[model samples]
Target: MKSFQELGVSKSILKALDEIGFEQPTPIQEKAIPAVKSGQDVLGIAQTGTGKTAAYLMPIFGKLVKAEGVDPRAIVLVPTRELSMQVGEDIEELLTYSNLRYASVFGGVGWTKHAELIEPGIDVLVATPGRLWDLYRAGAVSFKKVKTLVIDEADRMLDMGFMPQIRKFLEVLPVKRQNLLFSATFPEKVEELSHEFLDFPLRVEVAPSATPAEKVSQYYVAVQNYRTKLNLVSHLLKDEETFKRVLVFCKTKEVAEGVFKVIKRKSEGEVKVLHSNKGQSSRINAINAFKNGEVRILISTDVSARGIDVSQISHVINFDMPQDYEDYVHRIGRTARANEKGTSISFIAEDELFHKDRIQELMRADIEEMPMPSEVEIIPISKKEKLAQLREIDKQKRENDPDFKGAFHEKKKREPRKHPTSFNPKSMKLRKGRKDGNNKKR
Candidate 1:
C-alpha cells in the first residue's frame, strides 16, 4: 500500500504522479525506487503491464534531479523503435512537472533530427541498440555522464541476438554506473547477464519468472491445420461473450500478411495487421490506430509485435503456434494485463500436437482441450491422409533442392537456417513443390 510519496521520490516526480492520478505505487515501484535512490543496481523480474516502466523511471528521474535543465544522465536501451518511443512517452508523463528532456533515437528516422535531439545534453536518452551504437560510433553521443543504465525487456534483446551489442555498450559506458534489468520473463541468460552488469543488486521478483499475468484464463485447442486453427479463432470471436480487443500472433511477416488477409475477409470490421515487412511508418500508424481503439483486433507476427505496449487487451489468440516455449508465454501474456481478467486461446493442429508437450512443460499445467464447437464447422483429418502426408514429407528431401539449379550444379556451402520444429517441417514442405508437369519440385 505504499504511495509514490513514501518512496522518497523527488517532489517534482510526486507532483507528476499525482497529476497523472498514479497515487499508489505498484510492488515493483515501491521496491525499485529506494534501491535506485541509493544508486544501487536493481534487477527486477516481473510480468508485463504491472507498471514496470514507472518502477525504473521514477528513480532515474530522482537521480537526475541534481540539475534544472536538460543534460543526458540516464540511458535506457530497448529492442525496437516502437518500444523506444513508448518508454520516451512514459518518461515524459513522469517528468511533466520537471525540466527534464529526453531524446528517442532509432533507425529509419532522419539522422539529423535524431542527432540534434540526443547530443550535448538531451537529459534522458531512450534508444534501440543499433541506433545507439551508431550514435556512439559516430561520436554524436557520450555515455561518460550517464549515471544510470536500464535494459528494459532484457529477454527480447537476447531473442533478437543483441547480447553482443549490449555487451559492447557496457564496455564503452562508465563501469561505475547504476544498472537495471527488467523483463516479463527471466530466462537463464538474463540471470547470467545480471551478474556481469549489476553489483550486489537488490533483486525484486514480484511475480515468478516466465509466469503470465494473473488475469488471463488460458486454454489450448488442438486442431489439424492452419485452416482449422483459423476456424476456431473465428468461432471464439463470434461467440459474442469474449470478443473484445483480441490480439493474434503469427510467426512470420509473410504468414502474418496471409492470415491477416484471411481474417479480414472473415471478420466484419476492426481487423488490422502489423509486421516488419510493412514500412516502419505504416507499422507505427497501425499500432497507434490499434491503441486508440480504431482496430478491435490486431493480427501480427512476432518481431513487429514485440514492442506493443497496449494494456487493455481482452484476449490473445495464438493463430499459429510459436516455436519457442518462451515466445508462447509472451504471446498469451498480451491479455490478462493490468490486473484484469483475460482469456488466452491457443489453437494446436493435430500434426502440431508434438509441440503441446513442450508448451505444457513450460506452463507447468496441462492445457485443457475443448471439444470442437458444433456450430463452427471443423473439417476432420483422416488417419490415412495424415500417414500419406508424413510419407510425402519424408520423400521431399531427395527430390527438392533449389540450389542445384538444374540438378547438375556443384554443392553449395551455405549453411541451413534453424527454424522452429513445427514451422520448419512446414517450410520444408513448401520448398518441395507439388506434382505438376512443368513446375517440378525443384
Candidate 2:
C-alpha cells in the first residue's frame, strides 16, 4: 500500500505519475520498482491488468532521467505490434516532463519508415523481435549502448516462437546489461528462457501464476453448439446499458467473423472484428475505435487479449474456449483493468467442457455457472455439429488416456470386412476332387 514516492521513484517521475492519476503503486509495482532501481536483474510473475507495465517502466525511467548517447540505451521487446505501440504510448505519458526520446518499431509496416523515426537516435526503443532484427541487420539500429533490457510478456513471446530472435539479441548485447523478464504465466519454457537470458536475477511474484484478476466476476453459460452460443451473446448484449463496451473473443478468424456478422446485424452500436487476416490499418482502426468508445463490441481472436490496455471494458465474452489454458486468464483480463471491476462470461459447449476443466485447474477455482435465460431460444445441435463434437470429445479423451480407443475406432472394429479370393468355383472343385482321390488311394 505504499505510495510511488515511498518506492524511491524520482521526483520528476513522481510528478508525471501524479499527473497521470497513479497515486499508489500496485502490488507488482511496489515490489518491482525497488528491485529494478537497485540495478539487479529481475524476474517478475504477475497476471495481466496488474500494472506490470508501470512496474518496470517507472524505475527504468527514473534511472534514465535525461537522454544521452546516439544509440538506444534501453530496449523493451514485446511479442506483438499492438503491444509495442501501447507501451510506446505509456512511455510518452510517463516522460511528459522529461527529455528522454523513444521510438516504437514493429513489423506489418515498412521498416524504412520506422528507420526514419529512429534516425536521430533514441534513448529507449520498444520493438517487436522481428522488426528489431530487421532494423539491426539493415543498419538502421545498434545495440552497443543498450544498458537495460526488458522482455515484457515473456510467455507470449515464447508462444509466438520468438525464442531464436531473443537469443540472437542476447548474444549480441553487452553481457553486463541488466535483464528484466516479466510474464503473467511461467510455463517450463519460460523458466528455461529466464535461466539463459538472466544472470542471478531477483524473482518477484505478486500472485500465483495463471491467476485471473481479482476484480473480475467470472461466469459461464452452458451452450449446445456454436449457434446457441451466438444466441446467448446476442441475448445478453440486448441489455445495452449493462453490456456497453464489450469484447467478444473467438478461438479462430472464421468464428470471429461469424460472430461479428451476427452481432452487427442485431447491435445498435458500432461493431468491429479483429484477427490475423485483418490488414494493419484495419486492425489499428478497430483497436482505436474500441478504445475511444466509438465501438460497442469488438469481436476478436486472442490477438488482442494481452495487447489491449482499455480500463473501462464492461464485459468480455468468450465465444469460444481457448485451446491453451493460460489464454483463459489473458482473455478475461481484457475486461477488468487498472483496478476496475468487470464481468467475464464464457460459453462452454459440449466439446469445450474439457478445456473449461483445464482452465479451472489452472486457476484453481471454478467459474460460477449461470442459468440460461428463458427468453433466449436454445437451438438444437445439428447432426453434423453433433458428430464434430463427438469427435473432439473423443480426441480429448484419447489425449488423457492413450489406451482408450474412441467410439469411431470401436465402430470400425465391430463391422467385419470380407476378403475376396483369387480362385474361381471351378478351381475350387478340382482341388477338392484331387484331395478326395488321394484319400481313397491311401
Index of the highest-TM-score prediction: 2
Model 2, C-alpha of 190: deviation from truth (Å): 0.9
Candidate 1 Cα outliers beyond 4 Å, as residue runs: 66-71, 239-241, 380-442
**Deviation in angstroms for 219 in model 1?**
0.8
Q: lDDT tens digits, residues 217-317, model 1?
A: 87877677656666777767764445778898887877777777777877765788888778889888888888898888898987777668887788888
Poorest lDDT segment (10 consecutive residues) of candidate 1? 401-410
Instruction: Determine which window of 10 residues in candidate 2 has minimal summed lDDT.
Output: 427-436
> What is the Å distance of residue 330 in model 2 from its true position?
0.4
288-381 in candidate 2: lDDT tens per residue? 9999999989988896555888879999999999998898899898878888999999999999999999999999988999999998888899
* Residue 359 in candidate 2, Cα distance off native in Å: 0.8
C-alpha lDDT of all candidate models, in order: 0.78, 0.90
C-alpha TM-scores of all predictions: 0.84, 0.93
